[model samples]
Target: MKNSPTAGYHTKSAVLFVVFNRPETTKRVFEAIRIAQPKRLYIVADGPRRDYPGDVEQCKQTRQILSLIDWDCEVKTLLREENAGCKNGVSSAINWFFEQEEEGIILEDDCLPANSFFKFCDTLLEKYRYDTRIRHITGCNLQFGKKWGDASYYFSNRTHVWGWASWRRVWNDYDVNLTKYDGTEVKAQLKNIYNDDFVADAWTNIFNELKAGKINSWAYPLDFCNFFNNGLVIIPNENLVTNIGFKAGATHTVDEESSYANIPLIEIGEITDPVFFVPQKQADLSIINRDFNIEQRRVKHNAWHRKLKRWIKSKLK
Candidate 1:
């Protein structure tokens, strides 16, 4: 795959633009969308939260940027009157998107995507539109510097939603509350898929928060949907979307202590198909350890190592 000109490149799939109260970031993301020039654009904006002082004006300005559709495109919008927060707000917006579209690319106000990313997603969306096993098409590779397999993309069971796409068939199965996973089935499935010792505790906390309305994320439940249905996600070999909204006002990115901010987007030219269509188990495990369970695994390993060292020293004494 070599880098080429994207001058007149336009996406065949419609795009769903999710926005909120960041005009600057929205403007930049809107510029990226402008380049892709999608045929149909769906804009979803959550209203300003009452507690955030300047949210009203900021939300207004962000919506203004989102509406500057100068290119030849059909635009639809769902602008809320009151803030629904990220959990309900984003889920509801996506629900609105799939209600009209069979499949489409989804971009947040802060996800700066490379021009090539649109093509990548559009190609996969059409290719796997009917494949129930292939559930997600994402534009992120959080392996840090590690590349997986010998193809342009690899299959995994994780949900990397920095920039992604999905079909109405799969989105219809997306459960925000994951009410189906309320029993021992989640524990069994989590362990089987993730192969993590502490996946139970880690996901238990997340499910608890989701049930109690303690967190403001929709991505978590989407991950549950991916796992629950045994769906494989197609992740690019090179990163195509760079998340640029990890600043002070960000809902989750700022609070995540994440190392995934502002990654340089790589151009994925001449997309190649993988020889094997199976999910790379090692890649999936790597994502869990490096991203989800890093802190917990580190603490456990350190305590075990310390206890082992103490036992050896006492025996010698």
Candidate 2:
């Protein structure tokens, strides 16, 4: 426990902080969370890859980072025997987390969340514990609109697992293996979710990689499961967390410089009401960028280049 606030709903719930080998980022995130000082903290440290010189060193450093959490809160650690990679590592970690508690918050090593984020997650988790319709309570606001309406967050078709919290009931539905939904069955729904052709194609490629065992994953499949079950994820009006893990040892993230250049920020406002959904046709990228005052020109340009490379690769194939 770094320091306790005026005592709110956070102390009642469990918070599972998952970290891998990135000790620096892990240290910062734990430092941030330590401020909130929840009652219980579950730290899951992923094991390192074999035959890699830095693997064992990174694991040791990661453990050291976990030790930095100053809270006397029931701190538990799950150390892996062998490298399970990010997919298995996170998947196993979250599964273990849910098994311990009915509900909890999840924070990754590189994500830096605002102080209010813990309160936001805890309040929503307690409020919606019985509501099976809500699959996740996310801290990252990917698409919150300007006008504050019925709820603080809007329901998103895509599940952005940046800094999020959820219950065991919702996570129990997650299948990392993802045996359901062959290509033809969920084609239209997939198209709806990824309205942009480039984005859709990228996701398709990722799914293919997962199926072919090229890269193992659980997040994307968890997203698919959420949608399939008609479950909603509550997102904050303000972007509470920023991702700092864009360098080596990261499986998905590449091009570090371009990734963090003009990161978007969200404007926080009062969320007096709770149950709201952005209308079906209200998810315009331009409107969202304008509302948030986000300088997304660079991000759009990067997306264009990514699409171009994908297009060229497709033509070559």
Best by lDDT: 1
Predicted candidate 1 versus true structure: per-residue lDDT over 176-198, tens digit per residue: 88777675566766787776657
Clashing pairs in 1: none
Query: What tens digits encode model 2's per-residue C-alpha lDDT throughout 223-259?
Result: 7787678777776666777777777557766558743
Q: How does candidate 2 fare on TM-score?
A: 0.78
Task: Quote the lDDT for 168 in model 1.
Answer: 95
Backbone clashes in each candidate structure, one number apiece? 0, 1
Report RMSD (Å) for each prediction in the order shown.
4.5, 7.0
Q: Candidate 1: where are CA atoms >4 Å away?
A: 1-6, 255-258, 295-317
